[model samples]
Target: MSLPVHLVPALDGVVVGSTVTVEGDEAHHAVAVRRLRVGESVVLTDGAGTSVTAEVASTGKRVFTAVAADVRRVAAPAPAVVVVQALPKGDRGELAVEVLTEVGVARVVPWAAARSVAVWKGERAAKSLAKWRSTAREAAKQARRPWFPEVDELASTADVVAMLSTASLAVVLHEEASVPLASLALPADGPLVVVVGPEGGLTEEEVAAFTAAGASSVRLGAEVLRTSTAGVAAVAALLARTPRWG
Candidate 1:
């Protein structure tokens, strides 16, 4: 099995034989929960493309120290994917974020779609956003990703249009679209954006606005998918055709 991975604030200048210390909640989980001890191997990453393989040297009440044995830096994948997911009711939002992060999405944008049933207001909005971000962080670690996906703040249709104006490829996941996702030619490099509507589906105006902003409306397949899983499925399909997954 792969060694347990812990996220650090920074991995810059980390070298073999150097000691790195982990503290706070991360260390507590390692020490108290995982029972990490001396001589055990682990991996530490900053989640921005740097990772180190290390062996535990010591443990404390709420902290642990490890000696770096190897360091690796990965280049960010080309043609990063950005998914704009409309809010789903209940805990489905967290599910979407978790799967998207595991699927290698570069960023997840929570969209306040017109037909969405869930509303993020005031404190609830902050908490929900935090939940999505926390979910992404945990999922990334579970997937052993050196780079974590970002969870963007709630956005409106207009906001999404402006955001994807420069994207090399953009697609709106509309069930009624004439084109299939597989039919589109994906860019080998640059930013790519995918827009997934809410449980109630997209408003006509919203679809038009996104299409006018350079996004092509495309259907994943003949069958409909839930709001929570549509983005993950679409992203998997798109990435399969890209070098990142090829």
Candidate 2:
């Protein structure tokens, strides 16, 4: 089995036989909750493409030390994918963030669409963003990803348009669109952005705006996926055609 992975702030200068200390909540989880003991091994990642396989050297109340036996710095994935995911009600937002992270999206931008059933404002907005971010972080660890995906702050429709303008390729998931997502030529590098609407669907004005800003309105297929799932599905399809999945 893969050793339990813990996130660290940084793994700088770590090399073979280097000593690294893990502390606070992360170490407490490994030592107290995971029952990690000296001589056992664990994987530590900075979530920025740096990771180390280290054997535990010592354990304290809320801290531990490990000796790195291996270290790796991976390059980020090519053809980075950025998803403009409209807000979904309840826990679906978290579900979307989790699966999107697991599927290797480079970034997820939470959009407040015109027809969105749930609204994020005041304290709720902060809490919801935190949940999405936390879900992505945990899912990234579960996927053993060297680079964790980012969950951007809630975005306005205008903000999304500004984003689409510079994308290498941008597609808005529209059920009525004639163009299928798979038919589009994939970019070899740079940003490939996919926009997913909310439960009630995208308004005509929203569609026009996105298209005007350089996004192609495309369909996945005959079946319509839920707001929380459509982004990952589209991303999976898009990545399958790119060098990242190849």
Candidate 3:
């Protein structure tokens, strides 16, 4: 049977027969909400490539214990892809993070691009970032990923430029770009970056800056996608050509 996966803070030095204790909100959800019971099988991951397959030993108000019978460590995905996503309006940003996590992107950087419809400031910025992180976390668990993707802090144009300068392959999804994303040769092992513009689209200045930082302006296809979806589409297309999918 496919065991239900849970997220733990860490699982270092875990081995067969080790008792693992899960606590706080994670335990609460599994014990109370999911009705996890003694002797039930589950897989627990640290989101850093370590997992323990264990049977629930006990449950409480906000805690649970499990006796591990198997442990696994996986290597992180190669050619880690980072998407610099322009913040979209409403809950679409969370949607973007959710799909990106499921699609196996390594990181999502929320960018406040020129002409972005939604703005993040003060308390809203913190709350919004938290929501994106939460979405990524849940999506990762649901996807059964050993290495969870990261949701980075809000990024400025200059920040994205700085990141692109060191990438092995960098591309920006633009409707009017001459080059197709599939036409480019990708790196086998290194950081790959894709920039997705906002609902209002990227300004010439923003495109120019990214290009100057070594990102290629590339098109996905003939049809234009929403800011919330363009990143995942571009990523899926790129992954199809990569060994990760092969």
lDDT of 3 by residue, 1-246 (tens): 578899999999999999999999999999889899999999999999998999999999999999999999999998799999999999999999999999999999999999999999999999999999999999999999999998899999999999999999999999989999999998877789999999999999999999999999999999999988999999999888889999
Give per-model TM-scores.
0.98, 0.98, 0.99
TM-score, cand. 3 vs. native = 0.99
- Looking at model 1, how many pairs of residues clash? 0
Looking at model 1, report the run of 10 residues with the lowest lDDT sum.
184-193
Task: Flag regions of model 3 displaced more than 4 Å.
Answer: none
- Candidate 1 Cα misplacement greater than 4 A, ranges: none
Model 2 clash tally?
0
lDDT of 2 at 47: 96
The runs of at least 3 residues in candidate 2 whose Cα sits more than 4 Å from the true structure, single-residue gaps closed, are none
CA lDDT for candidate 1: 0.93
Model 2, 89-181: lDDT tens digits are: 989999999999999999999999999999999999999999999899999999999999989999999999999999999999999999999
lDDT (CA) per prediction: 0.93, 0.94, 0.94
